[model samples]
Target: MANSNGSKAAARDKRQRLTAAAAEVLHRQGVERTTIADIAQLADVPVGNVYYYFKTKDDLVRAALSAHADHLSLKLAHLDRDPDPRARLGALVASWVERRDITARYGCPTGTLAVELDKREPDGIDTEVGQLFRTLVDWVAEQFRRLGQPDPHDLAITFVAANQGMSLLSNALRDPTIMIREGERLRRWLDDLPT
Candidate 1:
């Protein structure tokens, strides 16, 4: 029983590590360019073992997307600890600024993946990938609602669009400073909103 339990724990850890590595590799290399061998190498697991955890590349990709969603949720939950909705929005911008360099290099993880997947044949993966933005927009809209905004959803869409645009430009120009500058402007915009 002890050995069985230990083996189960070890297997779970390896699966988690593989998924985490998949996310990083997919983020850096894009979905079409990444291979199972690359993910296994990054995870330090044998390539053959990857199949033990994931039956196909799409399955692994799904796992990676799920991981990204989980991370996003946790980050939003952490931001929600702030009582002020405006401040929460500011913090969201601040978090983006914090990741400016990476976003500049990788073009916003969710955005890049969504674009790549959307280009592929209709497999429902594109729609699944789109939920990431929906999650962000919904969360942002909730914050605006808390601030008594008349059109919370529209405002949320504008805010997210601005951020996504900033990310795209920063990545295209290879300039992290774009994110910082845009973040500052977003912060000011949030501050100017009616309480």
Candidate 2:
């Protein structure tokens, strides 16, 4: 029984490691370029062991997306620290500003991944991949609604679109300054909102 329990624990650890490695590789190399071998090597697990955890690449991709969603949720949860909706919105913009270099280099993690999945799998995985953006949009929209915006949903979507645009341009141009400038503009826009 102890041996069986130990084996189960080892299996669980391997599965978690594979998911984490897949997320990193998928974000950096993208789904098209990433392979089971790449993820296995990165995770330090045997290539054949990958099959024991994820039946297919899509399965691994889904697991990676789940991990990414969990991570994003944790980061966004930081906004709850501030009671003011405007302050939370500003902080959201600021978070992006702080990652200007990363965004300029790799683009927005969720946005880029969603585009890649949408292009390749389209109807199959696009919806699941989009949940990352959807959750974010919902949270931002809630903040806008709390701030008494008449069109909170549209405003929230616009905010996400602006951030995505900043990430896209910054990554394309390889210029962190673009993201920083956009962050400033977003903050200014937030400040301009009526009380």
Q: What are the TM-scores, per candidate, against the unseen true structure?
A: 0.98, 0.94
Candidate 2 per-residue lDDT, tens place, 125-153, comes to: 78987888899999999999999999999
Counted clashes in each candidate structure: 0, 0
Could you tell me how far off, in angstroms, the CA of residue 123 lies in candidate 1 after the best superposition?
Answer: 0.9
Model 2 ranges off by over 4 Å: 121-123
lDDT of 1 by residue, 1-195 (tens): 999999999999999999999999999999999999999999999999999999999988899999999999999999999999898999999999999999999999889999999889989878887998999999999999999999999999999999999999999999999999999999999989988
Those runs of model 1 whose alpha carbons end farther than 4 Å from true positions after fitting are none
